[model samples]
Target: MLAHIHIRNFAIIDEVELELEGGLTVLTGETGAGKSILVDALGLALGDRADAAAVRHGQKRAEIALTVDVGALPAVRDWLAEQMIDEGDECLIRRVIGAEGRSRAFINGQPVPLASLRTLGEQLVDIHGQHAHQSLLRGDEQRRLLDHHGGLEALATDTAQAWQQWQADRRTLEEALGSREERDARLELLRYQVEELEALALAEGELETLETEHRRLAHAEKLAAGVQAALAALYEEEFAAQPVVARQLRQLETLAELDPALASVRDLLKDAEIQLGEAADGLRRYADDADIDPQRVQWADRRLGRIRELARKHRVEEQALHAVLPELTAELEALEALDAKLEHLEQAVERSEQAWRALAEQLSQGRQQAAKSLGGEVTALMQALGMAGGRFEVAINALAPGKARASGLDGVEFLVSANPGQPPRALSRVASGGELSRIALAIQVIAADAGSTPCMVFDEVDAGIGGGVAEIVGRKLRELGERCQVLCVTHVPQVASQGHRHLHVSKSGGRQTRTKIQRLDDTGRVEELARMLGGVEITARTRAHAEEMLGQAAQSAALRRT
Candidate 1:
């Protein structure tokens, strides 16, 4: 329920604050009394598009605020909680439009994007009029209304979940199917590469060890020749250096015995002779061990060249060849198993399609049942709204079989005939502006119990209705208010008299023309009703007639309460 509305510098409304109450509230005034301006302000507060021209002449911006009671709407409370906005029993939506066509929106005084505000507004109130009626002309809206009225939300949710699962399965099948030809081509290449890698039989660290052995063997002849020359110099029989060093050491020992002062020199010569003999023996042993084999060296060099060639051909380091082999082997194995996997995927796709069709059939049945019940209820409401000869029908058609789509496979259309003996035509083609409004009202009334919005606003629902029919319309609006708050903009005296609260919209000229709204008391309401009855000429008879209408409305309201 809308608790209050405040408008400032918006069109003809310079500043107006309307405090609202529950049940039906009616706003009434004469022609050019700026009643429409009040509705426009409410629309802006509900996140309607803003225009720079709406700002007052001297003002930099226009502002509209609507405070709505949302305690009963769990969807709205959850949405606010998700946005991290405060969740109170009441929610305030405010819009400020600058002169430059820029606008800002606030929810509960916290700034938010206009889109968020629009989403929340949609969950709070629904404003119905000619424009709203035009929207109802669509087939989808009719289907949605039917679903809402028939209490089929849970079924629809189940269908949606099933459809989503079906789509996911189908997508997986498509991806697997699309790659079949490419995978076959890749399989042929993988098989050949794997066979080639297997034939090489490369071993880890084999390349490094082979290269080291080849380098050592290649220099063996030069190394052995150098060792033999050193051995000859150290151990030749006639010119043996070890014998000469031994003779010098013996002469130094004899001199040391002759004179003690020569003893230190003799000891040093003895050490030199011992070192020389050890060196000669070591050289002889190295010469004997250094044996060169040309054939073995050549074989090792050729093997190393072959390994390097294989490494280059495979585009890898010699040591990395071992790692590449396993990857190639796995690719070949995957290729071998591809056909079996594809067959399995094909079967899965068929299963998915069958599951989807079964669920779709169930959903279609539910919709058919709901459509019949909804059409009957709406038709009954239309008759009560003075369309006694009208016929209402729902037409459901099936779409082509394929991946599951949103709203299932059925395309629904609403058909109606405004008069007896006329063929029912599509609602969009047969319904006039005023007729559409009434039909929308009927649908809304039927679905009121299912709708979550706590407030409903009707802008001139009595546009083409008058007399007893207008009274019936007022009765219906009052009945609707029993379930949710209803704000109606009407000129009919009977409708105005039925309101639990009455607001009078009037314009006054100051520096600029401005609209104002005031909640009228019982006496004030009578004067306003009289004005609506007699226009500018409010006589005693008109006042008395207004009093009679009020009395009747009060009695009707009391009966409804009972």
Candidate 2:
């Protein structure tokens, strides 16, 4: 419920603070009395688009704030938790619009994006205006309104979930079907590529091994020739150097027998002969083992070249060729299985469509029943609001062949005939602005028990209504207030008299005026009602009449309570 509203430098309202209470509150004023300005300020505080022209003269900015009590509203509590805003018992929405058209919004004293403020405001209050009458003409809105009235939110949610699942399944199936042709071509290409790669029979590290062997074999002839030359120099019969060393060692041994110092030279010569003999033996072994075959070298080179060529063809390094082979094989296998997968997807789609149709049919039946009940309730409400001959109907038609949606398979449109002998037409097309407001009121009153919003605002709902009709409108508004907080702007004394609270708006100076809202006592209310009844003059008869109207309104309210 809206607890308070404060406005500063907004249009003709220079500064005003209004403490509001639950139940019907009416703002009454003469023409050009800034009544609309109050509503405009509230609209801005509720996240409506800001206009620089709304700023009062001599002010740089216009500010509006609304305090809403939401302690008992679970939806609001949950929403606030979700938004991560901190507030106790009440939520305050504030908007400041600069003279340059720049605007900012805040929730509970914490700055917030305008969009967030808008979302929260919608959850808190619903503003009904004459222009909103067009909503009755829309099939979608009608369906939603009816659904809300029927308290079938859970069923609608189930239907929506089922529909989303069905759509997802269908999308999966379509994607599978659409890829068949592409998959077939891909399968063929993968098969050829896999076969080509398999035929190469590439092995890890095989290229490196082949290159090493090729280098060794290419140098084999030169290595063998150098070993042979070293063997001849060390061990060949006539050209042997080791035999000469042996003969010199014998002569040194004979000389050592004559001189002790010469024995050291003989021992050194003996060691040199032993080392030379070992070196010659090593050269012989190396010569015997060296590779000299050109065919082996050519074979190693060809193997390395084949590996390089395969790597180049696959656009990978020679060592990475082996890794590519496995991935290519997997791709081929996947492509080969496309047809089977596609068949499964098609079956899934069929089952999903069937499930969707079943759920949609059930939902359609529920909506049909709900629409009937809703139409009856609204029709009764219309009769009470001075549309005695008005006929209200809910027309439901299928939007799709079999599939359902979040709302239902059927489209709902509200039809009305405001006069006797008149054919029912779309409510938007048949009703005048005043009739539309009353119709909206009726619908809202019927839907109040099912909706979550705690407050409803009607702008000039009493337009084009007076006398007994105005009294009826007032009674209905007061009845609606019993269910939810209602704020109505009206010029009718009867309507104004029905409110639990009354606010008066008037322009004082050329550009300096203010709006004042006060919770009226019984006497003050009567006085205000008298003023509403007799223009600017409050005669004794008018005051008496106003008191009588208040007494009747009280009696009606008491009966409604019973």
Candidate 3:
């Protein structure tokens, strides 16, 4: 149940704080007093779409906050826990809408997506707008209400899922069968491509190896010549540097006996001579081992040419050629098994259709049973609301199985007859605005007990009918409050008189007007009710009548409790 709400800079409200209770609370005010604005603010907190105009003129933003007591709702508690924002049994929801048309939502002070707030809000509050009857003319809405009334939402969801699965499988089968020629052509191409790539048998790093070997073989003669020339310069020729360094070392060693400084030069000459000998030996081995083979060079060049050709044919780099084979092979395998796959998909479509039919049939049966019960109840309520001998019916028409939709194979329409001895016809054609309002109220009152939401808000649901009908509507709402909190915005004096709590909304100020809501005490309630009943002027007689109404309503409430 909603325990508290704080609103700031919203519409005509500059700032307001309201401490709420769990019962039927009524808000009464003159037209344009912003009675519905409070309901709109609560709707915004519950994740309704926000508008920049909702922010008070010249204000930067509008803010709405609500504190909900979830002690009795284990599902809500579990949802809070799952979101990792649980704080005992109370949940705080806040909404801020900037003047620039941007909005943000928070749960327990932690920023959350608007969708998260909506999900949690559905579990906490069920708001019935004044215009609900207008939408009730829709077939889909009728079906949804029926399912909700019958507690068949889960079964309907299962049926929808099965229908979706059947459609998906059927689409796949149709696509495959329709594109058989294209599939066959693609299959042939993939098979050939896979074969060619497999035959090449390229390995990782093999491209770099082949290129290296090709360069080496192609330049074998030039490399050999360079080695021979270096060998001659270092040691191979007569009177080469090796023998010269040896003679220099012998003279330096002899002088070193006389002067120790010459010993350093002698050691340098000896090291130079040793390096020259090692160079000559290395050059001799290379001349012996050099492969200057024309046959191998030709073979390396042909292998490289073939790799480049295949790379260009496949529209890939030579280095990437190794990846092409596996991809083509996988596609080829899939196409090769097309017949088997089509058979499997056909069976899947058949099975899915069967599952969908079973669930839809079960749902149809439930709706039929629920329809009978609901029609009878709403018809009875219509009579109580002053539509004597009125008739209400739920007409279910079956749809073709081959063209089944996600909702089901049934189309539901609400039929109504608003006068005695009149044949029931489509509600949209037969009911007036006032009659629709009464009918909508009837459905809501009946379905209220079927829902588990802790709070229900009605925005002038009693908009049309009046007199005794208004009093009955008020009593029904008060009865509903026994199970959960209900907040109603109404102008009906009878309805306002029946609430467990009454709030009077009035506008003050001129250009910068602000809406103020005050909870009415006994005398205040009498005055407000007198104003509603007597309109522009409140006389002593009107005041007396308002007091008597309150007295009788209180007595009736006490009797019901007993």
Q: What local lDDT score does residue 129 receive in model 2, on the 0 to 100 scale?
A: 66
lDDT (Cα) of model 2: 0.81
TM-scores of the models, in the order given:
0.74, 0.75, 0.74
- Candidate 2, residues 25-96, lDDT tens digits: the string is 898777888777787777788888988998987789998989999998888888888888958788888999
Task: Compose the digit string of candidate 1's lDDT tens values, residues 28-142.
Answer: 9877878877777787888889899989888999999888887877777888899988658888888999999999999988999888888888777877763556777877777
Ranking by lDDT: 3, 2, 1
Instruction: lDDT for model 3, please.
Output: 0.90
- Model 3: residue 232 alpha-carbon error in angstroms: 45
Q: Which ten residues in a row have the lowest lDDT in candidate 2?
A: 509-518
Which candidate should be chosen as best, given lDDT against the real structure? 3
Q: Which is superior by lDDT, 1 or 3? A: 3
lDDT of 3 by residue, 1-562 (tens): 9999999999999998899999899999999999889989999999999999999999999999999999899989999999999999889999999999999999999999999999999889988888889888999988888887788888999999999999999999998899899998898888788877777788889999999988888888888899988887777678777877887888889999999998888888888888888888998998898878888889888878888998999899999988888888887888888879989989999999899989999999999988998899899999999999999999988987566688888999999999988999999999998899999899888777566778999999899878999999888898888789999999899888898999899999887999998999999999999999999999999999999889978888899999
Best by TM-score: 2
